[model samples]
Every structure is written in C-alpha cells, then in structure tokens.
Target: MPGRPHLIPGLSAVPPARRLGSSWSRGVVASAAACLVLAGCSSTITIDDHDLSDADRAACEALVADLPGTLAGKDRVGVEPADALGAAWGGRASYVLTCGVPEPEDYEPTAECSVIEGVGWYVPDDQLTDPAEDATPVALSRTPFVEVLVPAEHRTEGIDRALAELAPVLEEHLGEGLSCL
Candidate 1:
C-alpha cells in the first residue's frame, strides 16, 4: 500500500493502483491537497509518447484535433511535448487519453466489451485498478486503438460521459469498424 502514485513522474500520496469494481473509501486520497503537494503536479501531466508509424501518427492527429477541452467536468491540462498525441484533464487525480495505441494482446471474443457511440471498447477485467473512486482505464478495441485512463472518482458515469463526447470524433475520424474481440 504505497501512497505515491506510480505512473506519473511527480505526484505525491496518489494511490499506486486503482482497485476496480471497488469503492474509493479505502483511504486512497480524499482531498486534492494531499495528492497535489508537488510543485508541478497541478500544472502538467506526463505521458510516455508511443513510437507510432506514419499512418498511426496521421490518425492520432485527427483524433487529437477534435479532443474536447474539458472532460468529466475537468479542464484540459497541458502536457510537456505540445505535439504529443495525448490529452490530460484535472490535477493530481486526472483523466489521461492517448491515441494510436496497439491492439490488446489478450483480446477475446468472450471478453467484456462496451459499445458507446458506435465504438467498441474492450474492457480489461484483470488489469482494472480503481486507485481511488473514479480511476478506471478503458481501452478502445480498434487498430491504432485509444486508451483512456480515467480518474478514480468519476467511475463508470464519467467513462460514459467521456465516451459520449469522444465516440463521434473517433468514429468520424478513425472510422467505427471496430468490433468485439
């Protein structure tokens, strides 16, 4: 039960893992002050850029162009590299989205898949961690897939809302040929 956040570069007291399908009442992080104690934690979010091919890069550009400024009621925070095909919202407990991800290796036809806005999302059952109340990571099941790392507090409701906003953009730009499994 380490209190420091694992994925990011600079965040203090943020949970190391999100316990999906569980409640955030496990003393993960209740207040913003506890997680946002670092100097630059509140200002930026760090995302490891993927080495995308030319086509993937083009697709990522299309997806990034239409990304909404706000998601799940949080304003978009800037990342270090301006050209990165990723977006982040909120402070310590933030929502992170990256376009042009590779398809899931463990994808199965029987796996849990959710369709939102005509987009098929491969729900990862084993890797899900609710770090807090709203942090749930959902993956899009398409070539040049998209990965959205949701905050621990927003829960499924927030994912629904975010998908509602992102679905159309993904469909129009990336095409909605993605299917389950």
Candidate 2:
C-alpha cells in the first residue's frame, strides 16, 4: 500500500507518465516505422532479364554466381522472373545489379568516374553531389557492361561499399581493364 498509488473508483491516484521529447522513444518509433515499411514490401524483387550474346550471358552467369551472399550489410534476396543476368539485395530499398546491359546514353569519355578497388564506375555528376532516390552507377571499361541501381536511401557511402565488395568478383568473372584515368 505504501509503494502503490491509491486507486479511486474509476481512476488511479497517479496519472500516467508522458515520454515527450524522449530521444530513445523517438528512435524506437523511427525504427519501428522503418521495419513496417520494409515488412510491407515483397521480399522478391523484379529484375528484367537482359538480352545478351552467348559469351556475354556466360560471363554474367558466372558473375551472378560469384556475387557475395551479402552486400552493404543486406542479405541477398530472390529476384522475380529469375535470371542469371540480374541479382538483387535488401527489401523495399533494394540494391539491384544487372549485367550485360548497354552503356548509358549520357556516358562520355569526359564524364566523371570513380575507381573503387581498381574497378572503374561511371557515376553521374548529380549522383556525386545530390543524387535522386534511384540513381544508378554503371561499370566502366568493362565488358558485358554492368550497372547497379542504388536507392538514395542507401546514400553514397553504401553504394561505395557495395561497389567495393563486387569489384573483385567483377574483375574475376568479367576480366579487369577498368580505367577512369
């Protein structure tokens, strides 16, 4: 009785505590919101199959097979209409990689590029600064041209990590002559 608050006929003697301006509570709410968003998305992602020559298809298949089971802290997930030329990771905000794709229309020799782990990537100018939510970077100076669709939510750093992780596999399967210089 001493430690407990007295209860009236229809209410407790003490009012419920408020968690206003609580950072911890705010963080919990944000995390739960993110989880809900992700949960609402289908685990299977759609990746269109590319038309490629036999040799290019072979290389893409090999590359897809060699891709890491995880990238950028996200586990690899199944892709719908499954094909060897494409693979994807994460849910909702997914990282999609497609091989045997044609070069970007805007791609030019003078375009800005980023070299990660000795692999060259053609990053758009906007992507370098403030990228839209669905900017993609394509591999440069590599055969069977590859590209990765990185959601803006992942930011530049996350895309960099994904490119770094895939560089070795790309080099091994696609062969390396990547030059941004």
Best by TM-score: 2
lDDT of 2 by residue, 120-150 (tens): 7775554444443445667876778887876
lDDT of 1 by residue, 1-181 (tens): 3654443222112232332224222212223323345565456655557788888789888888788898868888886478778777776546677777666677666665555555666645554533353443344555577877655556544655676577767776674434563
What value does the lDDT take at residue 171 in candidate 1?
70
TM-score for candidate 1: 0.68
* Structure candidate 2, residue pairs in collision: none
TM-scores for candidates 1 onward, in order = 0.68, 0.71
Worst 10 residues of 2 by lDDT: 18-27
Q: How many pairs in model 1 have backbone atoms within 3 A of each other, for residues 3 or more apart or on separate chains, i.e. clashes?
A: 13
Clashes of each: 13, 0
